[model samples]
Target: MIEQEQVLDALRAVYDPEIPINVVDLGLIYGVEITADGDVTVRMTMTAPQCPMSGYLLQQAEQGVRTVAGVRNVKVDLVFDPPWEPSMIKEDALKSAGILTDTPANPVEGDCSTEK
Candidate 1:
């Protein structure tokens, strides 16, 4: 059986084309599942649905995770149901991005909360 930690480590290597940070740190990767046969499934989303590089980025993530020794198959699912907001970013990622502003980058309208 493949360890979940190993799959996470592989995910840490993928990055978004527009961001200087990796997808894991950016909070783009929502979930990861490793099946008994070592197949991996990743659920992820982009900052925006119209992101031109979404295809390329997802492909890279799938390929990168497949490079892990125990992984036999990789599948990446792209979703945008909840939509992505700057608030979803990890604290460390925000700090690294130098985004000290208390305001959310793409505020939706009435949802006001500084805490994520």
Candidate 2:
């Protein structure tokens, strides 16, 4: 049987070319479900809906999940609800990247873009 941990571990190997952190640590992965038959589904989102790497990232994430020993099929679902924010990043990953010393309650007000 395939385990969620194995799926997650595989995704950790997939890095966002635009970001230094892997998809897992980037908090891009929303959830992972593995069927008894080894079909794995991953619900995830990018920093923004217009992210140019969307297709490539989805492919990378799916390929990564498929690398797991028992995964028969990998489906990467892209969602936008509740969107993504700087605070979504894993604590350790943020610290390592020198992005933050402590997680914030609200990192951004609206629109993840840096334009001000």
Candidate 3:
């Protein structure tokens, strides 16, 4: 039987072409469902609805999940109900990508820097 964690681990190997972080860390993956017959379904969304890499990313996610042992089939569903925000990004991934902005010492000074 395939486990959800196994499928997630496989998905961690997939990254957005324009982003340094993987889909999991980017919080693009919303949910994972595994059937008794080893079929896997992934619910996910992109950083932007009009993202050019949408199709490519979906294909990558499907292929990535299919690599998991016992995963007979993989399905990826794209959703945008909640939408994606910068805050959804994992702390580690954000830091690594120099995307997490730190609070400025003085709000009026506007001294925010992207570098951690």
Candidate 4:
């Protein structure tokens, strides 16, 4: 029987082209289910539904999971009910990217137009 943890590790191999963190750590992976027959089901979502790379990301996730030793089939189901936010990023993942783990009190907003 294929271990669920191994399958999750495989799924974590997929990375968003724009993000430094892998999808799993990015909180995009909502759920993973493995069946007795080796079929796997993955429910996931992107940072934004309008993201142009959504199709590519989904395909990569599916392909990545299939590479697991005993995974016979992979089904990726995308959802956006709760919506994605930067706060969803795991603390470890944020730390790996060198992002401050502490919540910024009174976050600052800079106007990019002034730089020009």
Candidate 5:
């Protein structure tokens, strides 16, 4: 049977071309679902809807999930409803990238700063 952890482990190998961190640490992956028959479905979003590497990144993610031994089928879904934010990134990843900082109660207030 396909396991979600294995799928996630596989996905951790995928990295965004523009970022130093892997997709998992970047929080690009929203969810992963594996069926009894070994089919896998992944819900994810890109850092930006207009990102030039979106197609390549999605392809990489799909290929990564397919690397799991028991995954017979793989599906990657791109969603933008909730959107991606700096806060979505894992704390460790952010810290490693030197982007971690205190987040304001109202994120929209712009307390977070990005280093060009």
Candidate 6:
């Protein structure tokens, strides 16, 4: 059986062309499911709705995961239900990328919170 960690490791090999960070670190990967039959399904989203490199990114993700041992098939599903935001990026990655800010780069409108 293939482990989720292996799948994630493979994902770390793939990256968004626009950004230097990998998909996992960027928080583009939402969830990962591995079937008993060794099939892997990854739910992910793009940084933007109209990203020109979205297709290329998806193909890279699928191909990357497919290379993992014991993975019979790989499926990457693009979703936008919850949307992607800078706040979703891992804290460590944010600090490493030097993009960590006091507030989100794309904060929601009318969002007000004073809990610092």
lDDT of each: 0.85, 0.89, 0.90, 0.88, 0.87, 0.91
lDDT of 1 by residue, 1-116 (tens): 88877877888888887887788888888889999988999999999999999999999899889988888889999989789888887888777778655665785666665446
Instruction: Give the candidates in order of TM-score, highest first.
Output: 3, 2, 4, 6, 5, 1
Q: Global CA lDDT of candidate 2, please? A: 0.89
Each candidate: RMSD to true structure?
A: 7.1, 7.2, 4.6, 5.3, 6.7, 6.4
**Global lDDT of model 5:** 0.87
**Top TM-score model:** 3
Q: Of 1 and 2, which scores higher on lDDT?
A: 2
lDDT of residue 49 for candidate 1: 94
The digit string of per-residue lDDT tens for model 3 on 17-71 reads 8999999999999999999999999999999999999999999999999889888
Query: How well does candidate 6 match the true structure, expressed as C-alpha RMSD?
Result: 6.4
* Candidate 2 minimal-lDDT segment of 10 residues: 103-112
Give the residue spans of candidate 6 off by over 4 A: 101-116
Candidate achieving higher lDDT, 1 or 4:
4
Worst 10 residues of 1 by lDDT: 107-116
Clashing pairs in 5: none
Identify the superior model by TM-score, candidate 2 or candidate 6. 2
**Poorest 10 consecutive residues by lDDT, candidate 4:** 107-116
Candidate 3 segments exceeding 4 Å error: 101-116
Tell how far residue 107 is off in model 3, in angstroms: 10
Candidate 6: tens digits of C-alpha lDDT, residues 1-116 = 89999999999999888887899999999999999999999999999999999999999999999999999988999999698998888888777777676666775566685333
TM-score of 2: 0.83
